[model samples]
Target: MKFATAAAMLAAVLGSPVAAQNFTSAAEVRPILDMTRGSWVAIREYGGKDLVYFTHLLAWRCGLREIRYGFNGAAPNTPFKMEQCHDGAAQPNAISGDGVFVSQPGGSVKEVRVKLIYDDGTTDEARFTRDQILMR
Candidate 1:
């Protein structure tokens, strides 16, 4: 079968709305690259003891290495870290992890600082408010 035919068959069985597209030039991947250049903040980390809830850092596949995040002024260091990798292919963003930032009953989350480190040794930093994060 052809590539498109196989993709259609897979999408039909899996009910996947995400479709694939081919671009002629590499510049077409810029918009996707830009979207993944930000930080994913912690939205909700409640209702569970051993689980944590965070936002999606990257939407499209990229060579993202890891995401470093922590509270604003908690301590000397934040041990929370999220790792990203691609198995001979581009990898997605952090969808699940341990307790990176635990939500409290009365804790008012002010700002979350996040850093995105790519595989090319380049990094980007961005700050996100509570409303900026999305629930998984």
Candidate 2:
């Protein structure tokens, strides 16, 4: 009886999924300085002559929702590009992935790939890790 009870307790503890803390707003992301101020920038190397510039923003509502990007210094007359962003229910911009596994709420997992486009009409896709992101 003692062994059975101990085994049951162990199983219960181990089998239970870890509760993931969700961030519901863009304001919740603190690591990124001037998040509401300056744009996030990414540079990609093109066919040797062109350097592409990519800027983006992330927001969360309920789960994770907004993801938008556009050219660097797009003219006011130009329409800004945007997209619906998903973080698998984790914080808006806090989730990390390696193209194969995404860590999210309730210990849930997702497989995804992110593509970054630059103003110079260049695109690069890679397995982004958390460290690669420069929040500000």
Instruction: Write the residue-wise lDDT of candidate 1 on 61-98 in tens digits.
Output: 24455556555554213434444433334333333444
Residue-level lDDT for 77 in candidate 2: 32
Worst 10 residues of 1 by lDDT: 21-30
Per-residue lDDT of 8-83 in model 2, one digit per residue for the tens?
Answer: 5534443532232343333222222132223333333233322222333333222223223322232223222343
Clashing pairs in 2: none
Q: List lDDT for all candidates, in order.
A: 0.46, 0.31
Question: Candidate 1, 74: how far from true, in Å?
Answer: 6.4
Each model's TM-score?
Answer: 0.48, 0.29
Model number with the top lDDT: 1
lDDT of model 2 at position 26:
30
